[model samples]
Target: MIWRVATLSFLLTLSYLCFQPVKMEDGKEESMELGTQSQSQMDTSDSQNKGSNEVEEKNPSVEKSGEMKPDKTESDSGSKPTNNEKSANKTPEENMVEEKKSEKTVELKFPTTLEGFGYKFDEDGKLGDIETGEPFVFKVRSHDDSYNQKRYEALGEVITEYVYELLEKEANLKRVHIPVDASEGEAQSFIFMTEDALTNPDKLLLLIHGSGVVRAGQWARRLIINDNLKSGTQLPFIKRAVDSGYGVIVFNTNENRIRQGDKFIPVRESSTAVDHGLYVWEEFVSKSAARNIAIVAHSYGGVVTVELAIEKEAEFKERVFAIALTDSVHSLSHQEVSSSVIKLFKRIAKNWVSSKEPLDTPVPSRHRYECPQVSAGTNKHEETSWSSFESIFEMLDKAYKEVTEIDKEEL
Candidate 1:
């Protein structure tokens, strides 16, 4: 009777435990319907706001020279046309006017609009939606005027700054401001590096873009602002370097001044391209512990590197390993390169120029003074950046390996 009573009590306890309610973190016993309820709430919210999101996506932000195109009218389009569908020759106004001239005047047929694209047909038949009747903030280059130069300069400034933002966000690179010639608490300019590139020394890849409007992380401003992001920015170069166990530093050799609050302060160390590049090299690059350093410079950047090789003779001999130039504009006319320097440079540097010539067709030796050039497998000057990427890395690898081997042999 005792065993029977104990067994019955144990079965009752097990049944009670199995049927107990589930408690939440807040100690409230929630209904099994809570999950379904939450899901239903999500479905309802998404359904409610889906239209607005679609409307926002339809309103594209596209403009050339900040010209406020008259808001498109219902009569202007039979159906909303995409960039590809639109006529190449017709203006937006002309397209609308064409749409208004219907073949059957007696029967007016209103075309159905795409979802989210709203066209307001006011009583006046004019476009109801309009942009601010304002000109672009600055004038860009035109065939007719010189005042447009400032506008071009401003555009370059905007592009260079935007490129920096993309580099950090897209490539996840870090920025460090190295004081140009000033001591602590004085004026400084910036250079970009990877997370620990400054401290780690294994392999360092320094990226220097061409002169003029293009700043660090870009080869051309027009492509960056006008073309696709991948074609414009140096994110590709950064990623490749990171993958190859190389720390990267994007040199801002052209930014001679920095903004402080409302006023702009000139860097004490840098006033020109040569000044800035030399300052960055002496202060930051010279201090790195990397056994070898490689550089990828484009266009006028080649000239800057050539100057560095000429000026910093001892430092270049000790630390530099490889240098690649895309469509380099380095010339003997600008400054003379000694025979000894040419011999030192030819061993590691390869100039990739925009030409129809073979990739290895040597630039005619100019009295053995100027650096020899090679075709980067492209003829377009601006396209050299994108075209020479593969060739640049190949040269860097071969030269870098040779450098490492020599160091090992010495060891």
Candidate 2:
């Protein structure tokens, strides 16, 4: 019975030992699977960290490249710019600068400001005060006949007397008269200075006379006709101009004998009255010390005035702010005048052919028609004429009023 019990105990112990070993083996296998899973998770975490670090390092480079790119855009396929994208991308300042540059390149070249008249470069490529060089020397030429000579001399005397009276009567003007000789059968050019006239450098009056009329006599005589010289005359125009301060100078283109002819006569091309007038203007009036001047031309005087204005367009553009034409012959368009009357005059005046006929005359058309083709090259005067002198004065008042209005606006 003791032997049987010991064997049974040994058997049970052996079985227990075997069961324990199997349980230990199962635990080892579970632990091994858990360790492998942890190792795989750690490897995956490290790979993700490295990828994030690389993206952070490259971010600034991508941003800099985007800023440095030219004005362009990529399409859905990343090949070309899309229209909608282009519209949204550009800045307003860039667009404005481009538009301004285009306008400046295409704009017409014309005078736009006051400074442009004085300082702007001309087609000749010369600057201000460079072309004239020095003051011009005036020379007198005679075309006077015996009858016209006496008439001119008497006219001069009448004018000189009237001016002397004006100097005495008008307290504003300090007048000095310097007489030149007309004994050579030529019309005389008188130089007069007024202290009051010279006081205003900004404003100047250039009084130019028409054909068959001497400037020296006609200028003052017209004042008499207008009653500006008489005590009863209001003289408001003169007073206002003087009060405003202006320099006044008169030029006599018709003082020459060629201009005083009783009838139209064709003459040598060079000896034409127009040629002489142009010569006188270029040499005398254009180079005068009075830099700023406004022309007031009467009758055929418009011819001479227009010629000078056109010839010196670049020089006198600003200075010659206005041209007042009174009873001017060249103011009317040739088309406006009767062609029959023109034909009749041509036939009648044809008999008086001489060596001194003006190039502008004896033609089928009026003086204005010939003006464009003359040595003057272009016409610059604004035409103002009426059927009568009364109408002319009315227009003059209107013109003066308009000028005053413009001055006010500028101020």
The top-ranked prediction according to TM-score is 1
TM-score result, candidate 1: 0.60
Position 8, candidate 1: lDDT: 31
lDDT of 1 by residue, 266-356 (tens): 8877755667778878887788777678888876677678778877887787778888877665653434556667777777777776665
- For candidate 2, the lDDT comes to 0.35
TM-scores, all candidates, are 0.60, 0.34
lDDT of each: 0.58, 0.35
Model 2, residue 128: distance off in Å is 53
- How many clashing residue pairs appear in each of the predictions shown? 1, 8
lDDT of 1 at 273: 62
lDDT of 1: 0.58
Residues 1-411 of candidate 2: C-alpha lDDT, one tens digit per residue: 465334434432332222121112212111111111111111000000000011111222122212343345554667565544443476766644544454345522332331332222233322222243221111111211222223323433444444445444653443332122224444333333345344554666655544432333243232232122331111233454455455655444433433436643222221323454455445545555554455555445554554454455455554555555432334223223244333322221111111122322231223433322111111111111111223323433454556668778999
lDDT of 2 at 383: 14
